[model samples]
Target: MNTALDPTGATAAYLAKLPKGAVETAAHYTQGSHWVLVIGKLAAVVACLIILRSGILPRIAAMTGSRNRQNFAVFATGFAALLLQALLLMPWTFYADLVRERSYGLSNLTTGAWLTQSFITAVAGALVGGLLFIPLYVIIRRAKQRWWMWSSALLALLIALATVFAPYAAGLFNRYEPLQPGVVHDVVTDLARQASLSGEEIVIYDGSKQTDRYTASVTGVGGTARIALSDTVMRDPVDIPAIRAVVAHEIGHYKHHHLLILAGAVALLSCIGLIMAAFAFPTALRLLGGGGVGGISDASGIPVLLAISAVFTLVTTPVVNTVMRLVERDADAYGLNLAREPDGAARALLATTSYRAPSPSRLEEVIFYDHPSIESRLRVAMEWKAAAQGR
Candidate 1:
């Protein structure tokens, strides 16, 4: 191959603009977060063990003192345990989400902003958790031997609902505005048209309020479908070709319905995890001395259930990440082919190094990453360009 057409050389030249120090800093932050996440999962498991051993949940369940209020007891006990877990994890959350992000020059949020977002997110999560927990225990008690199957189905439904409503849920944290008439906007509209998407589905949002990273996605379904670009992309030093490539990538997601497909995949994974947790629940209860807990249906069993779920989640992280990474890489290929802007795609991927590491070892990427390394994605684009040039 000619030097001008060498994919590896071309990709390197495109990425050469990124300072080595910047890539190193991003890699340090990202890799450090991987360990933080692992440690957090371990800590959560330990907390659950402590809670179960303390018999605090049983004590909470006993507060109602009446079998008629079993539902209420379940809600109260579950909520209290969740609250305790949150309190236990607050310090770690603060460091990983706020302190560390700011240190890396990634977060654009002030302390007050962080606090506000955290409070809103926590409250919303608690409400959703309460709603789900009461019924989950109800399913356990009523369904008995078949609880796992029915409960998993319910969880799948909830996941689908969440996927459909995500666009609205996101509005609670950031303001979304329409893209103005401009080159970027026009390019996005053209790409959407090419991908058979409605122009009304594209919007820009104030994502810079939270992070300095360049981010975009196609969210929601049907009537709520939105191709959202962060205002970070609209700021000065706008790279038009890169924007076009990124938008095309998101358009590819929409065209292929990747979000719904991913939601289904996640729902299936959740079902598998729940089934495994159900099988382990009795054994776990026995190991924990079955203190003050009647069975899996008992409200006091919530801590043990949560612990089992955490363990399963930790074990399954790589599987979930692999599925997500494959979809992302496929979307990149689809976008490059559609947009015919391989250099732009390469540049756009390089821009992700603001927060993500540009490169990682194969094992690290397989185990920890939810997207292809920037290096690999750039190479894909360069290879596509070389093939196109040869043709």
Candidate 2:
């Protein structure tokens, strides 16, 4: 191999190219990823309207004796739709995450293992959501009149609870026990470091079990800090320097406390939304079924919840993207600082981008990106390299 460096390769880089149309390859068998999300959300929204309009809501309203009985009816109906939507979308989620990953040469999980993993994720989400949300949702109703103040307070409590509960969540959901840190001596020093932490720990969930991509995350509530890397990351994105680059970025999430910040933001927004829903739900309920406004009771709460859900979905996309970009920027720097190899980081971005749209449309990235676009991450990585060499 002539290991010659190009002008573009101001930093030493080595990696292989990715295979073709992995996503399309995935779509050959099942509904596409984007289709699943759009259809799921839209279906859930529509389901909500039908349940409210077909006398179900009025019946619930009549049965409840609370002052905010109408609000409860509307909330319950919307939530039921949400719960169902979550359940129905699980198949699509499996197709994209597990089945397609294997098709495109990424996943290594057998069907039984895949099914077990999916079951774990759902149960974990339900348990964590139930404990944190049941109280929060109950509180929201109690504070309907003082919606913003009490709702925000409740939301904050939930996030804190979630953070504290993260480790337990991971333990319950992770089908495999935490792998020994030395097992990844081939790369992933930072992952190993995080994994070895005393109070908080990391559990590698083998993202490759369903997809070919290497991924790692630290998620949960209070003392519940946990991190995990996929088998894909361990195998495919295994270079020590490149791995460090990614680890730096993952570390940024914790250093910057993204979960806590996101939780607080959700709390504040939800509180305002709770008060607004008291007024907004009625309109949303009516609009849901193309019916007149008068058909809904507690016009106040119904419209607001519907409006809040819509607004949350819309605004959160861009806002969360900006935060991710910022976090990514910081993480790239962390990699550069810790590994002293921006080229490795840049190359890592390129090798993996084959599976994910490396150069997605701005709208696409804004609407959907959970991480920085490959180009954006590369640009930042290059700048860091230039700065490191004092160029």
Best-performing candidate as measured by TM-score: 1
Tens digits of per-residue lDDT, candidate 2, 236-312, equal 43576666666666665765677666666666656665566666655665466535334323332232244347655
- In the range 102-154, model 1's lDDT, one tens digit per residue, is 89888889988888887777666756676689999899888988898999999
Q: What ranges in model 2 sit over 4 Å off?
A: 1-36, 53-83, 87-144, 163-168, 176-178, 181-205, 218-227, 236-238, 289-311
lDDT of 2: 0.56
Backbone clashes in model 1, listed as residue pairs: none
C-alpha TM-score for every candidate: 0.93, 0.70
lDDT (0 to 1) per candidate: 0.82, 0.56
Error of 1 at 361 (Å): 1.2
